[model samples]
Target: MKQLFILFLFTSLFTSAQTLETIFIDNFEDGNAYNWESEIGWEVINDNGNYVFQGTGHRWAVSPTQRNSNIVITGKFKIITNVFHLNLLENSGRYFFGIHEGGVYFNNDETQIEDVQKEISLNEWHDFEVFTRNDSLAFSIDNENIISYKNNTGTNINAKLAFECLDDAQIQIDDLIIKREQIVYNQDAKWVKTGGPLGGIGYDVRVDPNDANIIYVTDNWAGIHKSYDGGRTWLQKINGIYSRTGSTNDAIPMFCLTIDPNNSNIIWAGTFGMRGVYRSTYKAELWEFRGNGIPNVENLTFRSFTIEPGNSDVVYLGCEWTLFEDEVPEGANGASRGKIYKTIYGGLNWIEVLDADALVRTIIVDPNNTNIVYAATGIFDRDHIAGSGVFKSTDGGENWIQINNGIKNLTVGDIEMHPSNSNILLAATGRLIGFSREPDSENGEILRTENGGETWNEVPVTFPSPDADDWTLFTYLEWDESDSNIVYCGASDRGFYKSTDGGRSFQPTTYNAPFINAGHIISIATHKEKPNWVIANSYGGGVFVSENGTFSWSDASRGYTG
Candidate 1:
């Protein structure tokens, strides 16, 4: 009887594996559509009938719906484009083969895989396959081994598949084939130093005022890292910083980091995770929540921070307020609905002064007077929304007046005042938003105000039009502290431009910077100790250091991310 039972068990396992066959296939040809519905928690989009495998339903979703075992799925997909918009969650959720796993349907808390695959994009039909054998799982794209998982205890043996297209995307899929398999491939990259540049998304980076060699960088999805040897080697200082939102493989994104120039020991960091802002008096050895005055709600993005040059105690932060669809004023503000706060005594108390129903893009203090300040607000609406223009407050935050008279229909991004001259001000302006489609529309021009922003005029800079390489607007502008008359500007589509006579006339820098062309310059800071030692921050191309006044450049993003 025992021998007979063992034979029956083997037979049952074999039958289960064989029975895992293709039960349904929708080519969209037989006029028969599958019961397709989007998961309520996920965002879904349909391509223009080009991605359909058969008829007209090539569904794709970001942050896929999690599911469980006993499945064999395959599809013939052609990437056609180099865009793969997969937001695969880690540890917090499960991803088997390439399909994510978790949700209530799986009868468990969200379970996620610990590994991620590089974005697969080949403009040809590639066969994708996924299979599971009890506690083990495997996946492949076009027979090219991708990922495999083991020791996973999950239920609800079903999964959801969809397509994704965020920017100028197109794809096609057909001839889906599914079958059980006992073979699995090893497809994991061993953690080898490779002696190459450390790569990851760097959210915020700051140079230690006390020790220029000592640099601190916060990874947007990784934990906080510090380099004592000037970005040579990085050590993770995530003792108190939570990284639960990131993959066990990746780091949580630290949006902003600031160190008190007066006291390098006093450090502050703002995280984009479930945990909010954290402060460490002992240089990030240990940290505690410092988001008391700021909102404690979810998805609160702490963007820009400015410390009073003379008074380190006085700090200002630009934060993105949490806004729900129902909370908006019925098409009044569109996607722009955040606020700016200031704290005179560190984080003890915060005052909300500017509520323009728009994002406080950039904030800067008056170079001559600390009390006088300027804040640039603009609509963050992705589609179609207006900008709040530029606002100035002579009495700190007590009152403000829109100083955007000459600057009509311009969305202000960056504001910089001459270090020595209070009346000389330079602002970086664009159209209503960053992603304007109008080609002929004047995208960006440096506006100058010799009379403290009471009036303004466009500087003579040959801004590239949409026809010329699809270039658009200027991102960052900086005036030299040594010579306030010397200014530098960088654009997203175009490379770099410089102005010798303040904002009167401008010319492109000697360095074309083609490799760094796709990225926009974020901030340009001059070395206080060294003359002509300038550093520029690229949005995605990391950082560049220029020694010859923007005439020559070198890559300085040794430990930086996009």
Candidate 2:
């Protein structure tokens, strides 16, 4: 019996060095189809900007060789058929559920699978999960455990996972996840969750400036979480987070987090849209709403923010409109609504200091002179060239001027000021790949500005694996506080990178990043006390830690998922 379990996971290509997590994921955003063996009775079309398959009765879509004995497939599915007959991997036995039939059915043996009387509507969207394991096949709807069928009779090799509909039925599907083996990351790059109550993607992470053990991480759709015992455990520090009805975990999203340098207890979380900034004063134990001058209008998203080093009361926020959607609203204009705001009186009020049409993602204040500030505008794959240049403000941000003179890529991803020399500025710019099949384009660039973004020059950097030729874009640049010359840059899909020079050239770093499967290299952190200790955050793969240096990494994502 145990041999059957072991046989299900290990394919011929399986090796001791690497364990596969997710082999293939078809979110269908390409507007075209690939890898399917047959498209009979089915067509891939752009469903209001989301790619989905619209299939007719008796359609089949085959897959490539998945040699492992077990398989798991999931996606949002809806069928118009009165009786949905599905032949998974083989035609010898039929498995399906019908609105009229009342319960799930397996044709081979009625006792092989259990009956769960679940109602699936024709037009409404429903998620389905199916898996093969332990000489049994299981299927479920909306994550409910519904059916388990004996699986010894089907041919394993050259087998195909298929679907069949009856009576001129039509079905639609999206966000397909298919894998032959369950994901268990290996030793070199394992991810352990930092006990995040919210189990999705993390957009931002920060270690407290005062306490190395205190850390803060933000969920893409919920409140801020804090870990007192370094990241071993996490506490949802959302006493006053602004959110709608669901668990603060399901809110619009906490895009960024910042800890006050002077006061560790004071913190701010940037949220999506008009929810603006949520602040916590008493050790993040309780939260309260605080947005005075920042526009309270709809669609205003706070992307990036910063606070003055000595004066925690002074804050600068880079904000822009939420531009993309599955379907553009009728009569809605795709104009850029990027701007910067400032507040010197804590959160009592805010004042708009600059009005740039680019989507701003970073706001930096020179610690040497608070009067000089810079804002970076641009988003992944978004073309805001007319307004998407780095801008700077002198004399306390009263007014701004476009300072992107020599910089080539206008789609700014990040902007950083030098620690030793405040006049030296570093900028990263790029856009996400428009097509899923094509590699990320070579539009991203790292620029250096000695005159505070007045004139910029390209900084030479090398991308990891697949090497510099494969590097498409660069974002999320970090500096080693203990050694300013040792800098790190995230080469998006290309991989993580390092630079020994100040801002001139870079080579791929020692840390092996897995965001190619997880998310963008969003946030990378170096411990305040330990110059070599590092933590990198992924869009979905959770957190990774480097204990000895950049060369060694382990999965810190254990408790992140529920």
Candidate 3:
């Protein structure tokens, strides 16, 4: 009886295995691929006597073999220069598995399915496999599963295989094999949540005015987070924050976190998307929608926020009016410019103080005088180039005037005042690649002003030679409190610069550990008491610390979970 039962089980297994069959296979040993349709940058090439398909530039090659469902694709790929993609074309849509500079991703149509931040070694061969079962697709690299996603947009049909590479990418593929596999669907299977890797686009970090242990950070998408233990651990503080409905995101895009200089409990936050400003009166533990009189909150993008040094009720908000074809204001005067808004009653009422043609990105209130204020104007992308300079107001946000005299580029990003000298100031010109492209004339200029924006002169800083038509910008400036002459500036493309003779001249920092030498530093903070202890933030490299001054750096982004 036992032998008979075992024979029945063996028959059942054989019946299931018989459904899988090979559909198409290619080794390219003969150095010919007549069945593949090639584009301009794709060709069959011999590598060390092993023939393979090589693709360069933004081009693709299609295979003659086609399958609808329950298909398996196995191949070996190597990126010689940049990145590549394997595309599955369907009648209604397409799916792609691509390797990018930062990592790998899977996308259907234009929507992302999964993204993994990994640096794949270049010029090394790696095995990949993709399996499709109904609305589900499973992908693996080197026998290790990377991502498995289920698409609810119906089953992809009339599938054809294609190999492609992105701009300036040189990729090679070999040992292509296709099979028709019998895939049994597991109806009870569901996706489980696993925590993703830490670190993201950290826009701003602020320390508590009274206590050094309290810290707050704003993410581009994760709203606001706070740490009471000096960034060793953080807890999400997005209590009243709300993202747009049906956007598949629960976190709001928060930027420009400002803590009141006199009141540590009062903090203000500006947002990136249409969401308006929020005020946190309880030290960032809870928030409230405080933007009441700001016009067009649904189409406004706030870039900077500042509070009066002495008065907690007075604040400023820098914003850009996002242009919408169907929702343009009745009388926009043919331009969607940026505006500056001021509120004296702590965000209860706001009035537009200045209307400029460029995005108002940074607003600074004079620390010594409450009546003096400065607004810096520029944008990431826009059509008009007007109002790309700095503005000064002496009547406490009542009136403003342009102050771009002797400035090389009017596209100023950030303006800073000297700690003890109000007459001494620094302005960093920035780049914004918008609808109307601006010229990449120079690698961003750091302008020094001795007469408080009356006139400016370039800071004679040495920078790396730029690529042809490369646009760069400096995004931040930091001053060492212990030594006012020691200054630091951050750039979008050239990293960090230090100046010992105040802001007269500058030199780049040594590209030491934890720094990728590619620059892209955005924000830097210097301790007032411990001048040697500093923190710098990079675009994709996370955070770095320099305890013994800015000579050496180490990673300080271990606890970040953005």
- State the weakest 10-residue window (summed lDDT) of model 3: 9-18
115: Cα error in model 3, Å = 58
lDDT of 2 by residue, 245-348 (tens): 23643564677777776788888777765655767777666654566556556677777768888998888887876556533333333434577778886765
Give lDDT per model, in order: 0.56, 0.65, 0.71
Q: On a 0 to 100 scale, what is the lDDT of residue 51 in model 2?
A: 60
| Segments in model 2 whose C-alpha atoms lie over 4 Å from true places | 1-199, 245-249, 323-336, 381-387, 435-442, 464-471, 510-516
Q: Could you say which candidate leads in lDDT?
A: 3
Q: Put down candidate 1 lDDT per residue, 91-128, tens digits, no spaces.
A: 35434232221110111223444445445545555667
State the TM-score for model 1: 0.57
The worst-scoring run of ten residues by lDDT in candidate 1 lies at 99-108
**lDDT agreement of model 3 with the native:** 0.71
> Best to worst by lDDT, what's the order?
3, 2, 1
| Model 2 accuracy (lDDT, Cα) | 0.65
Q: Write the per-residue lDDT of candidate 3 for residues 1-562, one digit (tens) a residue.
A: 5335433432443233335555556665434454478888887787996778889899989986655577778999988887777888987778888885567888888998789877677888989888776566667777766666666766543477898888989999888877776645555786643223445666677777567667777766566777776665666676444433226655567767878888889888888766557777779765656665775456677877888888888889998776666544443323356799888877766888988877787888888887889888774334433646899999998888888998866667788889998878898876654333445633468899998789988888766554522555667788776689898887765556789998899887753544344235656666566667666655555556677767787665555544
